[model samples]
Target: MKNRHTPCTECRKQRRKCIQISPDQPCLRCQKLDKICARPENCALDPNNEVECLNQEVNELNQAIQRMEHELKTLGIKSPLYIKNNTMTLPRSTIENLFYNWKIKINNGYFTIDTGIKYISDLLPHYTSIEYLSPMTSYSSSSSEDSWSDGGSILIRFKSQEYGGFYGLTGKMLTKWIKKRMLGQQALLINHIPCGSRMLLDRLVDIYFNCHNLYCGWLHESSFRKRYSQLKEPLDDLICASLCCYVCATPCDHLDFNAYQRRDMCDYFYLKAKEKLVDQFDEPDKRLENICLDLRSEYEAAKVQTGIDYALFARHFSVAYCLRITLDCVVNKPITRQPIPFPVMNTLPDELEETKDFIRVMTWVNHLYEEPFVDMLVEQIHLILIGSTCTISFETVARMDQFLLDFGKNIPSEWRLCDNVFDEAKCRKALDQTTNPVAIHAFLHFAVLIVILYVTILQPVSVNDENDLLLQHIQRNALEKSLKMSRLLLYGVQRLFKLKTLSPCHVKLTSMIIMLYLVDPIVLQCSSPIKSSVLEAQKMFQKCLDIICNIRGIQREDTPPQLLAEKKDIKDFIHNGSVDIDYYDRFPDPWCALLHDVSQFFI
Candidate 1:
C-alpha cells in the first residue's frame, strides 16, 4: 500500500478522506463543514487520549502568547517611555506625586535653607525613637514609612536671628556699596573681552556641560545647547557668556590655556556679561553675579574697616547708613523672595520626559536653597563689622555660634553635615559623602564662616580687658572650634577638587582653610591629636593641589613668578611636612590678605 496523508478531524469523524489543495490550506472536507482542519492524530476520540490532546492544545496556546510578549518587550526596549516587568520605568503618577510633595514642602517653607531643627537631637535621633517595618501582615508598624509616603516629615521650628539687621545693611545697600567701592579698583575688575570665535565658544560650552553641569546641574544641557544654538534673545547670549566666564576662570588642560590666559578669557566674558546686565542689577534675577557680589562686599568692608579704627568706621558707617535709609528702603526686610522662574522647565520636549521633569524640579530646588543660603552668608559678613570695631563680645560669639549650628541643622538631608570632625571616621564620612556641587559650595562656605568667626574671637589682646580670664577661655574654645571646622573645610575642598568642581573662586576658599594650618599660632602650638589633624589637613591640601596641578598642567619653573612661588611653597610643605609660616604672612596671597583684614579685630 502507498503511504498517504492523514485525514482531518472532521473528515475522520465522518469516516471520509480529507482532501486539500496544499499543506498550508484547510482540507476540502473541513472547508465544506466550515470548521478547523485539525490533524488526524489530534482528533483522537479515545477516552485515554482526550487529556493528552487538551494538554497539547494548551501548550500551543501558551507558545503563541509568549511569542507576542517577546515582540512587545523588544518594542519596549526601543521606546523612550519603556515598561519592564509589567511596570513603567518611571511612572507618571510617581513623578507627579514627587513633584507635588516637593511643592508642598516649598510652600510650607519646610525645605527652606534657614529652617533648622527645633531640637539639635533631631539630626541624630536615638534608635528608640525610630519605627521599624513589621513582617508580612496587613499592617505596617513603621510610622516613618507612612510619614515618608504621605510626605509628612517632622517639622522643626527654630528662632530666626536678625541676620543683616545689626548695621541695617540691606542686600540693596550692600550691592550699592560693592559697586561704589569697586569703581576705581581696576585691577580687581573683570576685564573686557575684545572678541572670540564661535568654534572656541562652542568648545568652552561643551567643556562646561561635561565638567561643570555634571555636578552643578544649574543648566539643563540639552535645553542650553538648543537655546544657545538659536541665540534668539540677548538673555541667551548673556547666559552663554556667563557660562564661558565660569569655565575660563578654571584651568582646563583640554582648553590648553595657562592660568593667566584663562583669567584673561574669564575677565573678558565676565565684562561682556556685566555690560549687558548693567542696568538690571536691581532686578530680581538669580544672576550668579549677585551672590558673587556678597564676596566683593566682604572684601570692600574689610578694606575700609580695620583694627580699632574709629575714624574709618565712622566714615563708612555714615555712608552705609545714608545708603540704607535714603537709597534702599528694603534694608531691614527679610529676604523671602522666590527665585526667578526657570526658562526651560516648561519648554522642554517630551523625549526622556521623566528625566527632563526631574532636572526641572531639581534646578528649581537648587535655586530655592541658593537664595536663602546666600542671604545668610551676607548676614554673616555684615556681622563681621561688629568684630571689626573691637573684639567680638562673648554674647555675640555665642549667638554667632548658635547661628552657625542652626544653619548646619537646616541644610537638606542629602547635604546635611556632621558637625564634629575630630573623629577620623566622621572626617572620612564628610569627605566620602557626595552631593551636588552647589551643596559642596555651601559646605565650603559654612566651614569658612566658622573659621572666620572663631579666628575673629581668638584675636590678640592689646589692653587686657576685665574679662581676661573669660577671654583666655573663649580663645581656647575658639581655637578648638576653628581647628575642627578647618578640618571639615579641607575635606570639603578636597572633595570639590576631586570632583573637578573647584573654580578659582573656590581656590580662595581653599586658601583660607589652608591658612589656618599654615599660620594660626594656637593651632600651631597644639600637641599630638591636633598635630595629627594638621597632618591630615596637609595631606588633603596636597591632594587638592595635585588635582589642580593635574588639570592646569604640571608645575614648571617657566611658570609665572607668583604661580612658581606658590608651587615652591607647596613643594617645601610636602617635603619638610611644614610651611614657612612667616613667608605666607610677609607676602600673603590675595585670599590671605582678605582673611587677615577681615579678622584684624584683635583687642
Candidate 2:
C-alpha cells in the first residue's frame, strides 16, 4: 500500500498530476496506461531515492531537448530565434499547423502537392486572367474584354500552346519528371510501325472510339478526327498508334488480321507509339497543341498498362496519384458542361455486348479510382495492420460486411453476379446482363479485403459460454460469406476471360489478385476438402498465363530470336510445372518472392 499523498513512479516521470484510485491501488495515470505504479517507501527518510529519481527525470528531459534540437536542425531551423525570424513569411504556429495538416493528409493517403507549373499556377491566383497579356505590361483588371478575347486566341493559337511557352515543352518536362520518378525499366528508343492498309488503320481507329475511348476519354472525337484525318503532325500519329497498340493488346476481334498478323501489328504500333512518346520528351519544339489535357494524364496512365504490364504497382499508383492531384486543383471550380453524347457507342452491334459491358465496368472502376474513399479504405486497412490506437471491433467488421452487402444490393440488377458457379452457359448469360468487369473485379477485391480483416483480428477461443459460441459463430459466418463472395467474383472473372471479353486492364487486375491476394488461401487449403477451390484458383491462374502467352497476339515465325525464346521459356514453365524458381527471377521482388512462395502448391 502507498501513502495517500504519494504519486506513482510513472506519473512522476511523466510530470503528470496523478490521482490515486485508492491507497492500495494504482494511480489514475498508471491505471490508464496499464503500467505498474510504484511509490517510494519512507519518502521523508529516503533522500537518495528522491535524488536518483530527480536525476533520472533531468536526464530524460535533457535527452528530449537534444532530440527536439536535432529535429529542428534537420528541418533547417538553426535555433528558436531562427524560426521566430522566419515568422515574417509565415508565423511559426501557422507553419506548424500547415505541416501538421499536411502530415495528416499524407497519412490518410488523400493529399495533393502540386509540382512544376501547377505549383506556379497555384501561387499566382490571377494567372488565368492575365495569361494573354503582353509580357511588357503589368496585368490590370481594367484590360478590355475585347482585347482579351481577341488576343487569347492569338497567344494560345494552338491547343498545344494553351499552357504557353514553346509548343510541347510541358510534355517534355512531364516526360523528364516521369523518367526521374520511375524506379524500374527506363524506356529507350522505339521503332516506327511499318505502313499498313488504309482499311486496317480505319478499323483500329473505329475500334478505339467504340470499344476503348471511354476508359481514357482523353481525345474528343471531333478534335481527334480533325487532327487524325489531316495527319499533318506527330500528335495525330501518337494518338492513333497509342490507341491502336492498347486495343490490340486487349481482347478485340478483327476479320482482316489473323492472330499472328494482329500480334505483329500490335508490336509495331506499340513500339511506334513508344518512339513517339520518347520524341515528345526529346523534341521540345514539336507541336502538341492538339493533345488534350486528359491525353497528357492518359500518357502517364498508358505507362501503367502498355509498359511492363502489372508489375509496377508503384508506377500505376503514382500515375493515379498524379492524376488525382491534377484534378484536385480544379475540383472545387464552378464549371459545368453538358455531357457529351456517344452516338457511335449506341450504333455498336449486339455481338459486341460483352465489349460494351467491359467498357462500362472499366469506366466505373476508373471512377472509383478517382474517388477519395479508396484512400480512406487503404488508410483504415493500414491502421488495422499496424494495430494503431484506434481499435476496429468485430461489430465494425460486421457493419462493413453489411455495408458491402447493401452496396451490392443497390447495384443495378444487370451488373450483379449471378452466383459462384462457373457454368459456361450461365456465365455467358450473366456476362450479357453484367457488363462491368471493373465492378466484378472490385467485388472480388473487396471480398478479399474483408477476409483479410477477419483473419487479421480473429483469435482462438474456447466456446465455453453463450458469448463465446456467438463469437465463434460470427467469425465462421463472416469468413464463409467473404470467401464465398470472393470465389463467386473470381468465377465471374474467369468466365469473362474464358469468353475472351475481358480487357488488358482486367488481365493486370487478375495478375495482382492471384499474386497478392489468392496465394495464401490457395496454399493453406490445398490439403483440405476444399482442394476443389485450389484447382479453380489454379485454372484462374492458368487463364492469366494463357492471356500473357498470347498477350501480343500470335507471333509470326519471323519474330526476333530473343522474344521467341522468352515466350518459349514461359510456355514451357507453365506446361511442365517445373519448380525452377530462377525462371521468374527477372520479375520484381514482390512478384518473384510471392511466385516462389506459392510455386510448389500451385504447380
In order, candidate lDDTs are: 0.46, 0.44
Model 2 TM-score is 0.40
Q: What is the lDDT for 564 in model 2? A: 27
- What are the runs in model 1 whose C-alpha is more than 4 Å off? 1-195, 220-223, 232-236, 278-387, 390-393, 399-412, 417-425, 429-445, 460-465, 495-603
How close is every model to the real structure, measured as TM-score? 0.40, 0.40
Local accuracy of candidate 1 as per-residue lDDT tens digits, 1-603 = 223466776667756666878877998757755788877544335654655665676666668769977876566555543332234234466546433543212221122323233222232232211211111212334453212122233221111121211123223334444554332325534334323667778788888766545433455666567778877443336778788887776544456654545655666678767856653442346445666644543443444332322322232333343234322323433223322221222323423443343344344344433444333433333323222212222344555556666656666665555554334367557667665555565566556556654544454342435556665666567667766776666566657656654444444434433443333322222321345544644454344344434444433542446733453333332222343433432331322322222222211
Alpha-carbon deviation at 435 in model 1, angstroms: 8.7
Q: Please give the lDDT score at residue 600 for candidate 1.
A: 26
